[model samples]
Target: MEADTYTQSAFEAELPIPRGMARIMRFSNDQPTNHVFRRGAHYWLDLCLTPRPEKARGCYSERWGPHRFERLGEIFLVPPGEALHVRTDAGDNQASIACEIHADSVDHWLETPLEWTDRRLEGGLDIVHPYIRSCLSRLAEEMRHGGTGSAELAAMIAGQLAIELARYLEAISESPITGGLASWRLRLIDERLHRGGSTPSLGELAELCSVSIRQLTRGFRSSRGFTIGDHIAQTRIEMAKRALASDDSIKSIAFALGFASPSSFSYAFGRATGVTPLRFRQRHLRGRE
Candidate 1:
């Protein structure tokens, strides 16, 4: 665990004026002084964060949840038109670098509108979510070295980040079809498929939801985008992908996912995914670029 504590210098003239489309700035053992701010048009962000070096203390900002608090390692996405108060810090240890970006850099990929508000990653950052952290680090490097020619790089990085965020949201949505709120059936279905393929039959699914097949199907249609069978197929393929990564036998994999016969599983996997199971595994593993 780390504590935040730092006294910042008095307000400097407002932040980067005539905001550059891409800007690189680093903060070390520093705090941002109080000021009112709102997201203007066009913005993306990559912040390098770490535990505060000094004591944990204060911040009075809507950019953060209100509190005289410790600075945690998280990033804020200030979208256009969102208002925020950048507050004074009461922490003694804090260090971060922010690469502020404009929306023109990522408009096409905005999936869930995780825009210009304070979005906090719970607990500590998952440096191992390589798809995400790698892009953030890459964006930082581009901001650092690309200099004035960083716009193109920023746009590229924004696209990658947006996709990762979409995937995360997708995962969240798909995790509660059987055991969540009534509105979350689709999400649960999607999450199960993503997790390890569906081992549940219609009877099993209905039992899990404590409903009859007819009623569940009606409700699921209103919520889940795909039928139970289709979703199961999707989940099975995803699981097969992971299985393929290992040296497991195809027959064994088929049995593991509840296929009655290896041939049936391979045929279904190939027909739906356009590649036989073994081929899919080899291609993905051999071509992991």
Candidate 2:
């Protein structure tokens, strides 16, 4: 429950935060700030107030991929005891309202052990979830204009946020197709695909993992609910997303990813993401702006 407001100067004000309760704080600054906790005891949700071309980077257990604040709202959930560092270089002020939900509150809602699990909204952070957005806006308004019922209202909203987060975590935790591939094997395959290497056939994958084709297929299907071919297709699609986010041409991306033709690539991409390659790139480019 500690924060550091670092700046080039020395002017800071203590926020009137209710101890051990959920609260929101407005953050808008050009400079970056790293907030460290000796031991984190809260689940934090940050809603971006201004969309930035360069998404902010945070380091918890690992350095996550670069993420843009989609127009719907970009949210991040921080787990207990994990230090948080926020780097904002959007060329303008990065404005966002963050809500802190204490661990005890989340524990009351969730029965699972979540001591080190941090999560963010998946699928490019373009979440148009009405409830999450509305709760953030209301909490910000209440914090801005405090009154007798403001505290109660803020607490209720924070509780709802915690509930939503717990539900999402629990749902995702119940994934049926996890822990299928070995970490090393998955990483090796991911590297080869992401580096624009040729797609490996079933035989090649079997040799790569030192397993027979039949064994590989059986284990992978049982673990991931998808065959090796499907895994490769999905990996290539993810690589296509990264390439499309950059200035790479669709044709070049298709060729580099080993797609037989641009049309084939389009079909596969649409099937994987429900959108065409051009559409995915266009959406990302718009988000950058």
Candidate 3:
């Protein structure tokens, strides 16, 4: 696709690499906007250069089979021939570096035919790979400052990026994810939990992580060495402890923490800490005295 396809962002710089091209785009809009990216004959790997505003009404949403959104510092990869629809909310000031690598380059790097039908190769919306991020950041820095031997440096970075991407695809296609949720996903989960009001449901958490409930459960356990429910309970208990240290009434704290009732909150607190809320607060007060 042509660079003009990204009308939401202005092209700040472009670098023609070996069998690929990289461009930096800055998105600054005052109103919500939608952009459709038609599939082209190249793989598109984009890295966000700015932090997404936490309080924005709606950040970035994609329409690729399923609706998904991406966060700050996350990567979104679109395979060749796969169309993408993106919606950005109002008041978004974001910058990104996109590298468009031809399919031939990918095949060469992988030393195998690209499998478009493979679910793993269908591309990801929330990719969190450290090496890829580092490569992209290097490219961004180069693009920002075009000095001596910049072209050669950009080409080298692109080659490393391509090889790294190939390895990532191969690893995912060949093996199952036995690790826990990525740090970004975990941060999202924590954000949802502390965003105030009621605790998020399992389904909500799964949706936030862009995984099925079963996958989230298994991945969380594998990564955290504890169940997600256990983590949530622990978080609630910690919040309760902090609230107890204040002058807030136990009933209000219980209600604020999404417990059905004070009795239920006390029961959970006692079960978790081996002490009632009142006793915990009294102990803290005594310690202060």
Candidate 1 C-alpha lDDT tens digits along 1-289: 0112123322211123123333333233344344443456644343423222222232325445666343322333344455443444443322233434455544545455542212122111111234555556565456435666566666666567656644543333332234322745545554655454337767767766778888767666434332456546545654675576568899898888878888988998765444578776664453332
lDDT tens digits by residue: candidate 2, 1-289: 3456333222111122333433333344445544432237766666643343243555542334334222222555556665554555524333456666667776777776653422232311323333565666566556546678766666677767667766655544334444456757755665665577578888887788887888778766644333567557655765676677767789998999898899999998776555588876775554444
Worst 10 residues of 3 by lDDT: 52-61
Give model 2 RMSD, 1 decimal. 10.4
Per-candidate local distance difference test: 0.47, 0.56, 0.68
Better of 1 and 3 by lDDT: 3
Tens-place lDDT per residue, model 3, 1-289, is 5354566567878889988889987766565655555557788888755433232221222323445443322467777777555555564355678889987777677766655432353335545555787788788778877799999998888888888888776654434446668978988887787654687799999999999999899887655434688668656765686677778999999999999999999999876545589986775564334
List clashing residue pairs in candidate 3: none
lDDT, candidate 3, at 69: 43
- How does model 2 score by TM-score? 0.47
For candidate 1, the per-residue lDDT at 163 reads 62
Clashes of each: 26, 0, 0
Which candidate has the highest TM-score of all? 3
Instruction: Give stretches of model 3 more than 4 Å off.
Output: 2-4, 53-73, 117-123, 174-289
